[model samples]
Target: MSSIASFVRGVETLNGWVGKTVAWLALGTVLVCFATVYLRYALNTNFTWLQEAYVWQHATAIVLGGAYTMMTGGFVRVDIFYGKMAPRNRALVDLFGTLLFLFPFMAVVGWAFWRHFWSAAVVGEGSPNPGGLPAWWLLKGTLVIFVALTTLQGLAMIGRSLLVFGGREEFAGTSSH
Candidate 1:
């Protein structure tokens, strides 16, 4: 049990590190936006790539950081019924939801998305926008990446549910034993 707790702790720590990285990348997007405003309005010449760059970075950061958000309880949830449930009941609800819905969905969608990504990649696809952006497949790949991480997050959630049901503190809340 102690070893398992340590493993979870390591995952949580890795999650924090991943979150910080994405946050930094997102913050960098702010700087990129600033540069775009300068280039477009100030220099009187539009940089189309800048816009594409922002979308790519912004989306990547958010998707990659999703697990970290879940780790920190930063994602929105339908908590109307959740808040009313007792602890054990809540755990039960969470266990079933993760098992029956979340994990399987992530797996299936993640698998399906890779097919889309591969088709795009194999065809060397790009958007129809004239000088708009290059290689649409690159952006589409984020779907697979997001699903992979989000699936791991689902696994973490399941671990948390199990620990909670067994009456041991999980996530970042409990002291190391």
Candidate 2:
């Protein structure tokens, strides 16, 4: 039980760190987007790389921050149904949802993204648009990162749920919002 608790805590801590780090990309995304728009309209010039830069930053932030969102209970759910349920019941739902939905979905997405990333990496793929960013494989790799982080968080949720089932509700961590 202590080992399970340690695992849960470790995963949550990792996701927290990742989430905090990835959050900086949001600011970068906003700044780059503003620059892109200002350059296009105010300066009467457009750079494809600048345009794609914000998009890439936004995607990276979103993909990398998924586990952090999960840890913080930020994902959408039917709160009307979930909110009314007891803690144990909620844990049951979480366990089933993680097992039945999250795992399988992430597996498929991870597999697909791995293939895409490998292909791009092998070729050193760059943006298709002229003057766009290079190393598109890095962007493609974010999908795999998303899957890994999301899956890790899902496992933590399962461990937390098991704690709840074992009458150790205090270790269950945050409730879904």
Candidate 3:
């Protein structure tokens, strides 16, 4: 139980740090997009690299920050059913969901990401568009990162659920969202 508690705390802290770090990419995405628009129209000039830059930033934020979103319970849910359940029942649902649905989904996606990233890295893939960004493999690698972080957060949720079911209220704290 202490080990579970420690795992939960560690995963939460990691996701929290990752969440905070990736959050800044949102601002970067907006700034770069605004600059691209401004430069294209006002300055009568266009740079493909700049155009791709904002797109890359947007993708980076979404891909890398998704685990943080999940950790924070920011994803939409069909709460009409879930919210009506008792706390223990809610924990059970989360536990089953994490095991049956979330873990399997993550595994499949993680496998696919590994294959895709490996292929891209072998070729040193870059943006297909002319004058676009290079080293697209780095962007590809974010898929694996997303899977890993999401898996860690899922494990934390599972630990929290177990704590709830075990009647460890002191450790369970609050239900995840």
Candidate 4:
């Protein structure tokens, strides 16, 4: 039980740190977008790589930030019913949801894309656009990172649910050990 709690604590801590770190990418995305607009409209300069950079930053931020959002209870839920449920009921709901929906979906998608990321990395795939960003494989690799982190968080949620079911009422929603 202590070990499970410790694992949950570690996962939450990791997701929290990663989420905070990737959040800076939002600022980077905005700045790069502003630069792209300024360069296109004012200077009549267009750089495919620079444009792609903002897009990559945006995608990376969103993808990587997902686990963080989940950890912080930021993901949207049909709370009309959930909000009214008792704590144990909510835990059951979350446990079932994670088991029956989230985990399976992630597993399927991750399996489907496994070869794609592998091929890209193996071949060092690059952007098709001339002068576009290089190492496209790196960008594709974020898919794996996203899935891994989200899966870890999902496991943490499962652990929390188990703890709640085991009578650790304090593990209701938050991922504190």
Q: Mind giving the per-residue lDDT tens digits that candidate 1 earns over 6-68? A: 656666677777777878877779888889899888998777777778778898788778778
TM-score of 4: 0.96
Q: What TM-score would each prediction reach against the true structure?
A: 0.81, 0.94, 0.93, 0.96
Q: Write the per-residue lDDT of candidate 4 for residues 23-106, one digit (tens) a residue.
A: 999999999999999999999999999999999999999999999898878888889999898889988998999999999999
Indicate whether candidate 2 or candidate 3 has the larger TM-score: 2
Ranking by TM-score: 4, 2, 3, 1
Estimate the lDDT of model 1: 0.74
lDDT of 3 by residue, 17-64 (tens): 877887898899899999989998999889999988888888888988
Q: Write the per-residue lDDT of candidate 2 for residues 68-173, one digit (tens) a residue.
A: 9988888887799888888899899989999999999999999999999999999999999999999999999999999998999999999999999999978655
Candidate with top lDDT is 2
Clashes of 4: 0
How many residue pairs clash per model?
Answer: 0, 0, 0, 0
Best by TM-score: 4
Better of 1 and 3 by lDDT: 3
lDDT of each: 0.74, 0.91, 0.85, 0.90
RMSD of 4: 1.4
Residues forming the 10-long window of minimal summed lDDT in candidate 4: 168-177
- Using lDDT as the yardstick, the better of models 3 and 4 is 4
lDDT at position 112, candidate 2: 97
